[model samples]
Target: MEGHPPGLETVTLPPYSPELQPVERAWNLTDEPLANRCFESLAEL
Candidate 1:
């Protein structure tokens, strides 16, 4: 509730909500720089 620590907010989400996950939101940002780019191997990447 409103009594939570200062500047902190609590959120609750349904179990199946993929859009709310951090990684789900980060994919586009991470993918944009790598689009059409290639590395010789996994280690290079």
Candidate 2:
């Protein structure tokens, strides 16, 4: 079940697995820089 052209690769995920989703990991990291910081307004944020 593993075949792809040269260096190309494929990924598969099962249904309803938020913990395994890559987007969740990205969101977790995105919050880091804004964690302890305060914003002047919504526009500043």
Q: What is the per-residue lDDT of model 1 for residues 1-45, given as tens digits with 9 covering 90 to 100?
A: 888889898889998888778788888899998899888999887
Best by lDDT: 1
lDDT of 2 by residue, 1-45 (tens): 357678876778788788887697787678988898999999998
TM-score of each: 0.41, 0.41
RMSD value for candidate 1: 5.9
How well does candidate 1 score on lDDT at residue 44? 81
lDDT of 2: 0.82
